[model samples]
Target: MKKKVVPYLLVSPYIIHFLIFIAFPVIFSIVLTFHKWNIISPMEYTGFANYIRLFQDTLFLKSIINTLIFLVIHIPLQIIVALFLAEVLNQKIFLRGFFRAAFFLPVVVSGVVVTILWQQLYGFDTGLLNKILVTLGFGKVGWLIDPKIAMPSIAIMATWKNVGLYIVLFLVGLQTVPKHYYEAADLEGATHWQKFFKITLPMINPTIFLVVILSTVGGFSLFIEPYILTGGGPLNSTLSAVLYIYKQAFFYYHMGYSATLGLFFALIILSVVIIQKKFIEREV
Candidate 1:
């Protein structure tokens, strides 16, 4: 009895935490999806009304598209830049450790602080970027205000903020690749580019998959940059799915509908990750 009881005692904290926090919230959210409640009022069972409304919400659809656009721009650029930088830093270059730390600084900085800094740099009138453009005899380009380019601008900032972590990941992947593979390729007189394509890339497929998944998840969860920089835009161009759900839950007080949107969006994210896994597995 003592041995059995001791095992349960050791696990009780985790069990209690799971039930009180994770399990309860997830179950409650699911129940809320079928009911209408404004937090102050009694929940009224509406039974699919919220889900129906979610499908019909054009703004929500647009927000998902905006997030997808962000991923399309962000993922490829992130992988390329990070992989390139990792390749460089993996060499016996001067000040290599300092360069690695400098590149990773943005990843460790507060995201809110970074976004605010970029906001100033992207300002319409006094922005440093526009000032440079003007000095170079070019038109002042609107980074955040214009609907056409707002999402792209946010994508660029997101890449700069996140590329560091992926750089580290790629660096690990690069180092774990056996040196003898490259040595053998060199014996065959393979060029640097040929060895990179034939040996290095295939060895790091797992890391590439991880970076892609993380970038996709982060892109879907985009909020702070657009929220601060564009406030969903001059014409709702940069409204990410998470920000749209946040608006529904807090701003509009549509709790049930918000819960429904969250469930649906969660499914969408799961589907995307699954598809990504399948596609990469086949390629590998």
Candidate 2:
């Protein structure tokens, strides 16, 4: 009895911490969303008014569209590029550790810092990206300034920052695949393409699924990059759901409304992830 009690005691701190810090805040925030309060005075019950207002807010709707577009652009591209890099690095190569570390280094850095750096890189004049484009005989293009390209530019920056982590994920998955499968494919005169599709891809489907879910979540929640880089500007092309929520709660002091947005955002993420999980499970 003492031994079992000691183990529970050891974990009690973590359990208590999560309940106090994470769970309580989430529950309290949900409750706060349905009532109008200014952190002072008396709170009035508003029922579903906050949620109803969210549906009528055009900027909020635009934010939803932008976030979905960002996800469509970023997630698949990140996975494909990461898979390719992982495949390249999986082969017998010198400096494997160095390359892997180099790729993953950006993921560990702060998102704010990465966004600031990309801002410079995406500058219209004298930017490193434009400079390279000009030197390569391609005309200089406005990466962030042009409304049409602003979201894509942000998406590209996000991909650069995140691809390294996914590369490591895919590499770990790639290593777990049995060499005997490849050997068997070779014995059957399977070409490189055949071996990759028939053996490598199916075996690594789980990793692809993981990358999709993670990247999808990250893309939908994007804020800092657009906030610092474009301010969701260039015709609101880079606006995101989280940024919209931030503007509503902090900038406009509509805490209750913002809470509704948060709840709605959470529901979208949960629903999409569940659907994706079911699809992947069926395929498996």
* Candidate 1 clashes between residue pairs 3 or more apart in a chain or in different chains: none
Model 1 C-alpha lDDT versus the unseen true structure: 0.92
How many clashes in each structure?
0, 0
In the predicted model 2, the residue pairs found to clash are: none
* Local accuracy of candidate 2 as per-residue lDDT tens digits, 74-182: 9888988999999999999999999999999999999999998988998788799999999999998889988888888888899999999999999999999999999
Which candidate achieves the best lDDT against the true structure? Answer: 1
Most TM-score-accurate candidate: 1
Candidate 1 lDDT over 194-213, as tens digits, reads 98899989999999999998
Q: What's the true lDDT of residue 2 in model 1?
A: 98
Per-model C-alpha lDDT, please?
0.92, 0.89
